[model samples]
Target: MSEDEHETEDLQVEVAGLLLDHVHAPLLEDQHVRGVLPAPSEAPAVRVALGDRGECAPSRLTAYEIPLGAGEELRTSHDVVALLRAVHTGTHIYLSSRVTSVMGMDLYLVDPAHVKEAPFTTDDWASTLLRCLAHPSEERPGARLRGFLFREGGLLRLYMDSDEVPGVIAADVRPGGALTALLAALPSLLGEEWRTSDAVDDPHCRSLVDLTDW
Candidate 1:
């Protein structure tokens, strides 16, 4: 693995540790988790909660720098925690590495999430994550979902695909209510080319691609 990959794994490990440390344990389970999930409906309107405490810990800097050990970079626990929280929440993506390396990592993570039973591969990851990020916001719910990107040679890849999935089946919200609004918004976000030719099957359900950039 490259130095960057090593750092990302370190970040994930660190974040997993935090989930074990900070976030209330009860919340991890589906029961007390409340409606972190979406409601059930055909189509419903939703708005991006700008005021939501959208944050990235170690926000100022992702990876640490060392010099001679002087200008080198190091990863921190806070960075990992932030990424884990975002992923667990179904937020889009997050990172724990320096900005320069993030784009590449994103590409690496996408395949594992989208390819399903198919084996994850570098090319699969590249296409999935790149398409997701390259796609526009209307195609997705609040673009506020965030994550880190890592560099792979010259390309930017998504390292993590967070919980951007709308809680369509959870509670209160109908299945596709919020997702429909987002889908409606996609044509503009990704330009007319992204307009889905097929009719929405369930106005309430948010397709995996609908929530993320892909």
Candidate 2:
């Protein structure tokens, strides 16, 4: 084997590992419960809302799709500057999306009043989400657990908390109205009794690949 050929093979291995860690692992876990799923052919739309007191009423922002593929650098594509400008200090931001067959929801504990704010650019949702997911600073809180819910066969499966220590729950429910109603009622239902119930599983400590680069 030539030196150049060996280098190329090494690069291929690295890329494969990157895909397994960032893209394939999370979806593969869902597929274990849901069977085969379709690739994300189109970018998902983001829904944003302000968490007022304890009640959260979200509205649809502009529908912007950020590209995600191999050999592509992740950057912000949406007008995040305008959105951040409008957001007040100490406001809790809720971002949710239903992309293809996956429903993902997240919470950002925004503290814009602090000396250092969450690092994000005015470009795309991918960069924003990546920053929130891989945030380094401990002073400012980043993404919190709203969980990712997948539509599997005839059931809806939800995985909450960090990917490493996920709390999973499933139900024989479809998306749209039923799912929306369930999410709306989740706050009341996600108490100690709910966690201890037979429907919810004990935290499965599965370690996901650490996301280092975009």
Candidate 3:
């Protein structure tokens, strides 16, 4: 279907999964809602954290420190994925195919290009994303996707950043269509110019990707 429809579907799945996890593990009932993802449980009993006050604010732009259970504290975006793998051990976090439109980062869910069995080009990727973000909705005329980076594999990364040169930029570690397309476009996407190591080492980029059943 359309990108917005795909995003909505992905969001529904993510929320359902989160709710299911909570049902299985009461300790993780404290759900923090951030970015394009919808607000977590609103019941008074649930400890929910809404990252922004506005409707379409940037998704967790600056990193915040949060506990990863078991006394392990890590930054939200940077260390989350690695830490999640470490703590949860075997949980899987799926990613979408279109690198330009990663679920939860650019949009709230996995949105593949509308074309079937098609290898989406760069232009296709960018335009599809634009349409998805600007899709007309009942609440708002269109979406203005505010965030610049995505939270996948527990690390926050620039939305358009592509890894071409080794060690110059971090590659997409999350398994999804976006990673596949991004890796394919690495040669043209990444730059020859280099920056200091500190520029890429974002602390909030480190978040745990998976949550264990408590």
Candidate 4:
């Protein structure tokens, strides 16, 4: 193949991986992501008094360099699909790089109290968590939710002390929401039990890739 063609291929591969991360970050961190599953039109949202906002609203959400070590860098669109499927299969995908950013999001903990309350299953609680983050606000446009880190065996605990609960979720509040298009493609990934160590078989995550648009 010609050098220019190869370079373009490399670029596409890198961009594809970025696309995956863009979507993966929010799903990992955002609370009650509403659409990961099919929601009914009349469903009651898992409502809680919005946390004491502002004082806790943070400037940056950082991920430990640890969990990131497990993410895989995908090269093809199919790889992206494989990862997305994991969300529905009781599996998860974590941000694979050291590039966690400052963004506004909604994140809540596994409120054990809410666990037994009827009609809504754990799925409803998780969906509510996502909706709170994705809900519209004035700080940004298009409700650009971004960089969500959970507490207790959460996605970004490497940077947090062992005592923090209900980690922060933030909005892109930045330029393009960077992964706006990508995040739109997946569903909420919030129902997993926290405070426990579990292993996931995620093919969509990797440390690096041989760039080829193949």
Clashes per prediction? 64, 5, 23, 21
- Cα-based lDDT at residue 30, candidate 2: 27
In the range 23-129, model 3's lDDT, one tens digit per residue, is 22321223223322332332111112223333234444212112222233212221222232232223324354422222233332211121122232333333333
Maximum-TM-score candidate: 2
Q: What is the C-alpha lDDT profile of model 2 across 1-214, one tens digit per residue?
A: 6554444344433323322322222212122111111113322212232222223222211111211211332222222222332342344343443222123323232222322323332222232333332442344322223343333342333333432234443222233323234434433343324233353232432222111110
Q: Largest lDDT belongs to which candidate?
A: 3
User: Which residue ranges in model 1 land beyond 4 Å of their true spot?
Assistant: 1-22, 25-71, 76-190, 205-214
Candidate 2 has its poorest 10 consecutive residues by lDDT at: 29-38
Q: Candidate 2: misplaced stretches above 4 Å? A: 1-152, 162-173, 192-214
**What do the candidate models score in CA lDDT, each in turn?**
0.29, 0.29, 0.30, 0.27
Candidates 2 and 3 compared by lDDT, better number: 3
Q: Give the least accurate 10-residue stretch of model 4, judged by summed lDDT.
A: 205-214
Candidate 3 residue runs with Cα over 4 Å from true position: 1-11, 18-163, 167-194, 198-214
Off by over 4 Å in 4: 1-119, 141-214
TM-scores for candidates 1 onward, in order: 0.19, 0.21, 0.18, 0.16
Q: Estimate the Cα RMSD of every predicted model relative to the unseen true structure.
A: 19.6, 20.0, 21.4, 24.0
Clashes of 3: 23
Estimate, for each residue in 58-93, the C-alpha lDDT of model 1 and write its tens digit. Answer: 222122111111125543433322222333344334
